[model samples]
Target: MSDDQAPSTENGGGGDVETVEKSEDHKKLVDFGLDTTVADELEKLFQAKLVTYDDLDPRALEAIRDFPIECAIAVLKQLLADSNLQHVNNKSAYICGVMKTYRQKQSLGEDKPAVTNGPDEKKLKEILDRTGYALEITTGQRKYGGPPPSWDGGPPGNGHECFVGRIPKTVYEDDLIPVFEKFGTIWDLRLMMNPMQGCNRGYAFVTFTTAEAAREAAKQLNNYEIKPNKKLQVNVSIANVRLFVGNIPKNKSREDILEEFKKLTEGLREVIVYAFPDDPKKKNRGFAFLEYDTHKSASGAKRKLASGRIRVWGSEIIVDWADPQDEPDEETMAKVKVLYVRNLRSNVTEEELKKIFEPFGEIERVKKVKDYGFVHYKERDSTLSALEAMNGYKLHEVEINVTLAKPANENKARERRMRRERDNNMNMGYDDYYSSYPPASFGPPPPMMRGRIARGGMRGRGGMMRPPAPMDYYDDYSGYGQGYGYDDYSSYGGCYEDFSAEYSPHPVTPQPPHRGRGRGGHHAPAPVAWTSNAAAAWPPWYAQRSGGYGTAWRGQSWHQ
Candidate 1:
């Protein structure tokens, strides 16, 4: 026979060995150097239906690989014996049972006989450690106390506690403890209770015996609904170092307050100063609240500043613990019924102001003084609405300040009135003046008449100089020579005859018309061609100038 088919005496047998053909899977077992006797036994077990090659746990095969073939067979036999079977029914179950026995023996520090050529105590320990089943083998019990280990990577309940928020108010300690105890041992559990209601305050603190427990509980119970509608909020509990600061300066702002406390110590988490409600001035009340990351910083600030005073805005402010239950009285709270308006223009009238505020609500009354006013509303809701709508509203081209009106003080009122009067005096000069009389009646007087002098030095009719004759010099209708001044009318023939006979009752003999010079050397009459049309159509002045009768006239000199 060829060497491949040769029967070996490795099993120490002289009888002719039957060469059994190995399947591909059986060849793999043989290639691992498993003894032929052991393989034969395993094949017999498979045939008997006690175990199958597929049923053998790979982990068991892996665990025994480093052992000698005889030793590996002995381990397998021990497993079967422990299970009270001639062969393992479930190979994987049998392997797990062997591991459990090993662990139990190791934990008890028992010296069990080694089934291998040498002791495998170290190997067994390695297997348990690699599988993470060795926690109990190391730390037998958790140590308590001291700020639990840095929880950075530590498991919950290792050294940390958790804060459970948004818990149902009806949940009590007994109900909460049992639910978390499943995660690990509970060190302590505190559910904040309301003093008056004697019920839970919707939050609690839970301390687990170990960080691992706390972390596990936090992971599973965070946002876990304990009630139908409420869910629990679990988080790592921070130290309680929040403080209440009282007697803050009314004028100090939130930033200013923060800065003040920051001087006491560093690490201030937050600062909140309560302010007067609806105050147009935006002033704060005399109290505040502060928070620190640790209790030490918070307590230090209280110790240093509580017994002493802090000066702000020229006033010494008191510092004390602020009670969370304390609140401003309802009477002191801002109520909308009256609005205080400031920065008003002097020219804004009550009627005009009324129109601006009227749209918000029914105005009970509006008391207006120079640059400020007060609008009283009939209803509180209307007042609030008006304040909201009209605050910072521009009126008369100016942004008026609107706020809830507080009680009037005598000194403040007097000061306001005085200030307004002074302002009015200062700005009155800039305002346009209004007159009581009609505008048209207050202009310059009418212009005077101007005239020129004549060539003979006689003033014109409209000039300041007076004329020689009166305006009525020719009042009579007698013929010219009968007297007033012109004596040339007799030459006009019958023209003067009608006038002379009517006024003198006798006819004067007709004579040629004559011309003569008067006082200024100006001729009294100038001869002209007379016609019957002229005599019939001429006026009294023209007839006199034509030498036909009557005294010289003194109106504007007429030119023919």
Candidate 2:
């Protein structure tokens, strides 16, 4: 065909007739590594039902791409034969005939150089290989021969290995070996499994036969989709130096701890601070593990910082060699059944404390002393449930601090005893140590009263002295004059009238009746009857006064 008539597949159109482009389907075919010209022809064929549309699907395209052009033509011829349509009119006939003729010539003992195919044919073969489709056409059948070989011979892992993450859970050893074998010979393939479930744990380890093969696989397959909705993560597997760090401040972040430790040393690969798994903010858990690139660096860091001199967030942290195997043990340790309760009110009784904790679990015992105590539960699971439910809860009007109590130790026991003693001292009173008595006397008691002191004599009932009855001042004054009698004063309205009114130019207003102090110290109007009753309740001496009480006289009245 002339260059002009070769085909204009760029827009999925042919023979000078413009066609409505299915750009999305065309792009999908192209992404599967189909040449534009071939893809357009295949679309035409599928539209005409000359070839099943499913034959040109991504899976089919991937399979066909694995073979060389000659092999692929052979496979197509076999498919035509199987369909009993070997003579069907199609544009692919020329290539198929050429390959058939070549094979016949070879069968007849004639030597010929392999066909020199065009760039388009070469590109098609490359696409097929990369898509992981393998077709064996030599046997006159178009059957997939599994994925193409990664290497011609030998197992992988000669010098390199790769880490694969995000593996699908349904993937198995058989499923992985065949797919990854396309990249290179795999010496060892390990799909990490959940020990309890015996299923894939979403990751794998692949060791390739050659470093170059491993590198190629990692570069080409990183983020490569291996299954529907599951992509592979490929990374170089390196030896890691893990260091254990303890006593980390709970407020310190991974970045902060890394920054502080990085200042002390270099070559840190990664730093991971454990956190409360359920917390959305991921509060730190006061410990962490760090990875280094080399064991020497890790050992050096441990040697220099293990003395607890390396401080992070003003807290000296403990550093030591980390054994990965110990992780499970540490997790087991977290399932303790004892809880430490702090910030309790000193007056909280044991019964009250039991009520606070009994809702969580059956408490075996409660060892409470003053403001802190421990609650031992019947089961570890109950303790965990209670801890999660009751942490930072309010008890006895105080926000109690609750945590998993560490295993008891001698030092902790000593500390507790010391604290108890201190609390005891604080609660003690002076009455507990000394008896009370009257203060030392400064002089002798006063002498007894003299005989015949009063009308009742010196003593009365109950041997107690009694003061003489109040003298009848009214009677005594009554004899003085009729005007001095109490009744005479009462007749004058109890208030002393201004007797000096005649001496003054104007009669006195008799001063507005003395108002009583009201609520909030403000003076209020006094009732007319209250003035007379108040005057009557006053002492005998005050009733004899005239004019308003003076300031000096007021002081003397209060003294009296």
Candidate 3:
């Protein structure tokens, strides 16, 4: 054996010796002596194991293929003898590590190469595994768990196509068996059947052993019409099924409904127009759900509906608008108003603040309220500007809270209440003084009637017992009688006729309505004019048809 395969004596004599066996792993060397033959053999061995040499191309090593193993081994031994071979081999090993990493990365399919040619079975599995795609295995039934009626039990992994259609299950299984078996092993086959219908519905599911066989079956059978009395359509078993039944005419049967939608969509996967079990008599439930195997066919159905494909029976089919996810916008009108701010330092007056916000907008009105200690702005924008500028600015050791002003009506109501309270206080004080005791000129009651006797004595002793009257009294000066019941003015030289006229002993004649008017009744007609006008026009009618009549003509005549 060569040194490469030499037995080591590192282990002691044969007493269950502990041996240091040399690792046979390949190593890198900076210098390798010439031995092309052995190097080629090593390269082939690594290639067979799917190991790559980073520094050397696998294609380049192909030239040494015809060389004998003995010759290759000789070349490898010669290369290993060189001192610098170790360094070159180390470089090669480093490159190989990087290439191995890249190959592992490729397996992950991060940047997958396009698969133009159909991938084989193994490649399909690898792709599916990498992409988390499922085979989507399914049995022949509308819902799950119901088996095909004519189930001629087949093995697992049969190379056959599966689809959902309206053709009878008996016909689908009988016709599809021979045709699908042409490509490869038909491991499993099923024709989808409605349990209640008890017949094939023209749809089936099939599986094949090999992916290539399935692909071949799909390509050859798709759109190929087989006429067994009526033409039967075939297509690939695409999984993009959109099953929805809406907007069905109330008067359509299962067969009639399928026929209508079959004409509508080219690749009609399914068209079921059955009413609910509870209401079998009801017409079609007013809608039908359809399932299409391909997006193209579903979109085609939508296009057909758009082009007036609706048929009316008891009621016309309708496609409802989808409800929006977001609520509709509400519109509002903006209002502008004056704002009065309070709780400001009295030193920070109105004019100074108005100047601060003057650049932002027009300053309509600004006034300081020292009473309540606030600055009021009539303009909306000025208030906004002042808020924005001085909102965070420290004023009177506090940041100002600025916003739009409250309603002026509210402020006015508050002020009116305050003024009303002040007026009420003044009225209360005046009433108290006015309601007290009467003045001295009104006189006290006489000594109280208990002394009624003294009151009688005072009353009976009149003019003779009384002292002479003072000169201030001119009662007898008039020529009236001066007896006990008469006026004292008659005792003087004064005439009683003048006194009687002044006193008005005779009933006075009533005064006529005033011709000299004041603001009180200035608009009223004069007494003479009122009498004349009333007599002429009371309840009068128009003299001419076009002229004014009685009360209907007020301030101005209709003719005028």
The best candidate in terms of TM-score = 1
TM-score of 3: 0.17
Clashing pairs in 2: 65-128, 156-185, 156-208, 156-209, 157-208, 157-209
User: In model 3, how large is the Cα lDDT of residue 459?
Assistant: 21
Each prediction's TM-score against the native? 0.22, 0.20, 0.17
Give one digit per residue, the lDDT tens place, for model 3 in 324-415: 01111111002333333333454776666666656766665554422111234456565556656654454555444333432212232343
- Positional deviation of residue 359's Cα in model 3 after best superposition, in angstroms: 98
Residues 1-560, model 1: lDDT tens digits: 55433443323247665444344445555666666655644544454555567876666455545445554454454433332232224565554444444445546774242231111345434533443221110011111212323334322321246677786655654356557768975555555544223245567666675766776887798888888977887755433344645445567787887887788666576775434333435445454557664445666766666544645455544332321111112353254376766556667888988898998879977755334566878988888898889978877656666666543223323433343344335433211211211122211112222321232222211212212221121111111121101222211111111111112223323222211111111112211111111111111222222111223422223222
After TM-score superposition, the amount by which residue 134's alpha carbon in candidate 2 deviates from its true location, in angstroms, is 27
TM-score of model number 2: 0.20
Clash count in backbone of candidate 3: 57
Candidate 3's C-alpha runs over 4 A off are 1-238, 276-280, 291-296, 306-560
Mind giving the per-residue lDDT tens digits that candidate 2 earns over 103-163?
5655777434232211133443554466454432221212222223553543332125667
lDDT of each: 0.44, 0.44, 0.34
Model 1 C-alpha lDDT versus the unseen true structure: 0.44
